[model samples]
Target chain A: MELLGRETRERFGLRSRSQAGILIFSLVSTMMLLSSLYAAEASVFKKAREAAIETASPILKFFAGPIGWIEDRLGAISDYFRVLEQNEALREENAALRQWEEEARSLRGVIAALEELEAYTPPPAAKPINAFVIGEANDAYVHSMIVNAGANEGVSRGFAAVDERGMVGRIVDVSPNAARILLLNDVQSRIPVFVEGSFVEGLLVGRSTSQPTIAITKLANGDKIQPGQRVITSGAGGVLPRGLTVGAVAAVDKKEATVELAADYARSRMVRIINYKFPDVEATPLGAPGAAAAAAEISAAETAPATAADAANLPAAPPAAPAPVDEGD
Target chain B: MSTRADVLMRLAGAATPALLGFLGVILLASPLRLFGGEVPTPVFPLIIVYFWSLYSPGHLPAASVFAMGLTHDLLSGGPIGLWPTVYLVTQQIAISQQAYFLGRDLGVVSIGFAVAALVVSLIVWFVMSLMTATVLPLGGIFWQMLATVACFPLFALAFGRLHRRVVIEV
Candidate 1:
């Protein structure tokens, strides 16, 4: 190694110098390319990238078909061995579900009477469009997928995408017949979520991993959180529907908690794109925007001793938007 | 080893490494997500690029290396030039040190490949960190490197047979 380095230095000739020059040139060119791509014009490049993908999608599908078929066949073969155990588990789950169904029916009757007295009307149920995952983002850093159903199938941007297991992601970009879903674990993803038992609100910012940590923005300093807690979408942002299963807490620390996602992204082949629209916050009763702004101001005004009191003066927990009613398949 | 079909055989021999590199990228991109997200992606191309560049630089040219990297980048959804840069640099380094590996046995080559795989992984991690402007987690990258290193022998065996049957005959 030392000998080679010394030889490279001492025996510098036209050939060696040319090779070194080529290496330097290539390195500089690559760096320049990186800088340009890093600061790429989002609008122009996004359209171009989408167009390029659209054009190439057919070829990709043609190649991917055989591989997908083989994978499914292999999965089927493996499932054959576990069929008995799965059947038993399913039977047990079915019995438990029947009991829950009976309980829900009784609760529904009581809730109906209460709603009649209060004159309450729940939001309409969201329509879900089923789509097969055709391809995933080729880049390792970008956790995303391209589903077959797109604008043609009413799969549009802001629609939350979920699989049978749980929340997968939401539609980011849609073409005529295909849509791109930015998965939950993508770095660019941030969704409002809460602990199921405690109902503690937090921002679930994706760390590009299954074990994404939740930043408890609503919590005061030194507040406690624990492992094994279930996380669910809070629907604070309105883009995502409420009560969607996110994941269970994998680890908890003094400040943040990591969640192990419920959806097995690696193995998920199909997903449902939910057609949902955020309610008009501007026209709401308490003006959610105004209250949110006030909360923000109180949060920012930390130096003042009366900060907590000032926060208290904000709207006393304005009524939450009607939760989206789940419609079972 | 020359015969009436020498030219055709040689051309096919020259193309095998790039074809294998392409297949490696395909295997990574296909539904068979190697190790199922425990590792982001195995450096399959890195193994082939290093093996061929060291053993038979003439058969695997720099142009083919760039093409393989570009193809992978297109399929990978990463920064377009990242893998190309990595592959080209790895190939150059391997070619430069080909003298050291010429008469070495499989064991020595495996050790050399392990070291090369480590270096390649570091380069990829550094470039990706710069691209994302964040210090990314190294665990996945390390796992990917180990996976790539482990799979190198299988590729070596297959490529060795192809080379012996084709190159030696041609």
Candidate 2:
């Protein structure tokens, strides 16, 4: 009877310990979840997350190697099967591009002559950093990818990424060796764009789908945006450069139109991160104006009293600058 | 063998689940781009947590589950704490139903996992939508749940073998 009593006590003790383990761990998990949910952008949690990704980047790259190899092999097989059709299409495209090339050469000469006449100073060339995609997160709520390029490789937040076809996304987070790209299809993505010919400005908003739609569209001269019209970055806010091909309008609904992106998210292994720095308007004057004159102009503009009439005469303030691009944690 | 060696071996055995769980997270996050399509990734860590919690709760503790889920969140660049909470809930459910899972055949075990996957999917979708303040698309989550359910048998087979080889002593 004494032995049976001891066994019973030990059994109860073990059960209680197990229960305590569950309770304590549950509390810890809850605390962690709450902290992560409400943490600030520069909070320790975000920093730690970036550090962890940087440490594990090499491991991810190593694992992607075999998968990329398989993808290449499959692509080669597909290419082999479609070679004849692709060859015919390329032949036609080459013939058309040859004609465009001659026209482009003539236009380049004219533009150079005009620039010389006006003493036009071109903007600095954009530097592109080539990087391989090592990881991807395409779930129901988040759409991002990790490229094997970071601050060390001249990749900074807000730098645009593009594949051979067209725009892919913009870098949002950068660690030492890896950067997170908020893909174009993420719900939080918004880019300033305009129709190719009509120049109707609008915000391209992501819907977490393959195709994003244009919102807050401003039609110029009653020009209606039609399907198949090309879309390009407007460079309104000077974040992205002008004339970067975004996509083609797939469908127009009442006020908005869906765009079929040019960059094939799938099968894009390499991307180019374009490092574009907006020219400082305050620092570089258009002509050879003295510093005092430029300063005088700035102070006059700031000190000039604005009347309701002056405000009305001013051009409508550029459509509410699109919200700063940042993905929620 | 020395006492220290014996203890070390036991600790290592105990850590098998967490180690495997982390590796599964890394593998899932890698850009496999399988079949040249935007395939939804299966929550492999959840499967690992569910399997171990059911088969040997003492070996796979809640803390390890939390660590694995946290790693997944950081690596996948998703909302923080999202997967960790989902995984902790999954572990609790699996532990609560452990008795019912014992002595069950593979088919029954898979069905239980299917149910668990559904619950996990719903929690992720619902919580993410709330966090983002938008009703996220449902099609991706549905396909992800299907993928997770379909891959359960394979993971179970692997984990079962590992359990027999390494975790049994712990």
Candidate 3:
């Protein structure tokens, strides 16, 4: 290797130099192309990347369908073995949860039904389409995952993505057949949350680390945000719905509190797509500014710390769009 | 013993499966759906690349590695050049170590994979840091390396044989 390096140095002829120059030029041009690819808005490039996937997806599905079939055949052999263990575990856990369910039902019976129920009504989610994963880890550093479902499956941005166990992330970019999930572990991810203990509201931030943290701004530092206390979405920014299960306050580091998601973020599979779109512009096609109004408002609520001043704010949801009805109606 | 068809056959085997495996690995590693979110890291690609680099440089061209990396970049949504760059760097290392690798046994190769996984994981983490502020625990990356390195023998042997059989024929 050293000898070749030395010999190449010695072969500094005009032709050799010309070849070197051409190589250098081509190299620079490729770098420029890649840089431009990287420089585009994450959403634009994400869409383009999704477009690429859309074109390539069919080819992949062609292979995946067969592989999935084979895997199922093999998995069936193994499935029988875990059945006994699964049954015992579920029985024991069910007994404990049923106790809580009874206690909770008694409390609910006492509360006034209508107004309280309205506050507790869970938001509707988008129609989820399921797909088996056909790729490797998407990003380890960021808490994100890419699933096989995409726009063609009615998946769109701002939809909630959760595994059978718990919340994985929200959909950020979508192609025809695949979508990228921005996990609660992503540093850029922030959703409004309320402390179940005191209803103290704050935001859940996805820090690239495995354990995501909740930043409670409205509650003064040293407010009774104790370890083992629970946290949930407060529905402040209309992005995530009210009262979604986030996680418990695992530990408090100084003024900031870190949360450990109930579901294992590191290990997840068979995620459910909760087909909910934020109350912004409609979940329209690409370039449709349908959700613009809601998007801007949600973005503002996410970025600006909620304070006493914004506490009294209740921008009524736009009158429900008239349901698409039959001509007879 | 090597023939002209060697290149054609290796490409034939790895071409579809290597990229196919890459896509498969991403979905398997996805933390979206099921229990035990064990994500397969760059190990599959790394193993395929590393094994081919040592055994038959002819079958695995640098350009193919570049394309695989770009595909990974798009799917994972990391900075575009990061994985491709890591693939190239590792490919170069594999080629350079081929002489020493010729006589090494599986244990040594596993250790070599560890070293390579460490280097690739570190470089990927660093380049990815420049993209955004997602900072996953090093433990996650390290555990990924352990799993990938542990499984090296399977892919190495499988890919190596396919290289021999297909390349020998084509």
Which candidate has the highest lDDT of all? 2
User: What lDDT is obtained when candidate 1 is compared to the true structure?
Assistant: 0.73
Query: By descending DockQ, how would the candidates be arranged?
Result: 2, 1, 3
How do the residues A135-172 of candidate 2 rate in per-residue lDDT, one tens digit apiece? 98867667788999999998888989999989998888
Model 3 per-residue lDDT tens digits across residues A176-287: 7777777787656787777777656777887666677877778755567788888776767666666667788888876578888866654454577777655554465434
Ordering by TM-score: 2, 1, 3
Docking class of 3: acceptable
Identify the superior model by DockQ, candidate 1 or candidate 3: 1
Write out the backbone clash pairs for model 2: A329-B79
Provide all candidates' interface root-mean-square deviations.
3.5, 2.1, 5.7
lDDT of 1 at B64: 72
What is the C-alpha local distance difference test score of each model? 0.73, 0.82, 0.64
lDDT of 3 by residue, B63-168 (tens): 6666776666666655556666676667667766765887789778777777888898897666555455455456656766777787888777776677666654
lDDT tens readout by residue for model 2, B1-112: 6898988888888888989899888877887665566567776787898898888878877777778877888877776777877888788778777768988998899999
Residue lDDT tens for model 1, B62-139: 677777776665554455667778777777777677768877887788788888777867877777677657787776
lDDT of 3 at A323: 42
The fnat score for candidate 2 comes to 0.55
Q: Lowest summed-lDDT stretch of 10 residues in model 1 chain A?
A: A320-329
- Return the number of clashes found in candidate 2: 1
